[model samples]
Target: MHAIDVNELYHILYTKLGPRHWWPARSTEELLCGMILIQNTNYKNVDRSLANLDAATNFGLAALLALPDGQLQALIRPSGFYKNKARYLRAVLQAYHDHYHELAALPTPSLRKRLRDLPGVGNETADVMLLYVFMRPAFVADSYSRRLFARLGQDAPYPQLQAHIAPTMRLNIAQAQEFHALLDDYGKLGPDVFGLADQYQLKL
Candidate 1:
């Protein structure tokens, strides 16, 4: 097997799928809220949950802080894990002011560490937020990413997968964001079963 060129994959997907327009956040606060809401859930459910929150609290940070836990849980029920998610969202809100700031003011490593220290933020989540929301150079290694890379004979641990893409590409914010989105959309649009082309152009 040959090595999978990360940039080649990125370009292939970009050319095939065009723009996926991912992350789906209009503001920094919205992105932070989505970071908590999107845990272990799909975008459809997250969109519904966000709509509920928007209608209920106008997506205001103070309103989110003011909303009772039970109410918060109810509003975000569409995304699942409502109770834990509510707590996680609040914890993120508590930390956002301190750890999050203008992108120019903070380094990627420090911001990533601070985000990871917060509850409910694992490696994948931290990297996603860094890459999409903070516009940093972090390759988000999700399950789809691993599966795609593995097919190309680049099987590795999560951090290793990130490393594999990080050095050669050094992808900027737009490219990194588009690459992640393309991987996810391609995985979903590709065949459900593995080891087969199944109407998709993604070669193994």
Candidate 2:
């Protein structure tokens, strides 16, 4: 297990991926909802779900809470795990209503903690909400991140990858945001840009 030079990887991937413009949310609420819905599914599925929801109504706190569970489940079906994702969405909306009385009123840390405590939420999902929706400094890790680091020969586990990359991201919130976007973009481009065959000795 060898350590990877993330700074070098960052530069290489950035040059390959260019500007990512990640998270792809139109609003704070949409971004937060997308973060939850995106789990275990591709962005295309997530977009389909969002489009379905958006076509029917505004997808606001009140609108979503007002919708029937079955209807909501149907709308977000594209994201897969419909019933479970619906339940998770309902719980998060309820938490917003119950605790802060409104989405705008919720404090970043408190909201993040509450969301993280929910059944389906995990570090990656929570960090997405924190970073994209709340504009916080949280780092997000996904399979792409893990694969990229592993292909670079960093033998550390996924959890440890965050610590390794965070410090090198310049300690500025904006830089962290860009760094994440770049990594995500690099991931979206797949292994081709990272010299996957040369690095891992595998054929594409």
> Considering every candidate listed, which one attains the maximal TM-score?
1
- Superposed model 1: Cα runs more than 4 Å off: 1-4, 102-104, 192-204
Estimate candidate 1's alpha-carbon lDDT, on a 0 to 1 scale.
0.77
Cα lDDT of model 1 by residue, 57-89, tens digit: 877778878889999899999999999999988
Q: State the number of backbone clashes in model 1.
A: 0
- RMSD in angstroms between candidate 2 and the native structure over all alpha carbons: 4.9
Per-candidate Cα lDDT values, in order, are 0.77, 0.69
lDDT of 1 at 81: 96
lDDT tens string, model 2, 78-157?
A: 99999999998887667656664454356755766676797788878876766665566666666767776666555466
Where does model 2 exceed 4 Å of error? Answer: 1-12, 97-113, 192-204
> What value of lDDT does candidate 2 attain over all alpha carbons?
0.69
What's the TM-score of each model vs. the native?
A: 0.85, 0.78
Q: What total of clashing residue pairs does each candidate reach?
A: 0, 0
Instruction: For model 1, name the residue pairs that clash.
Output: none
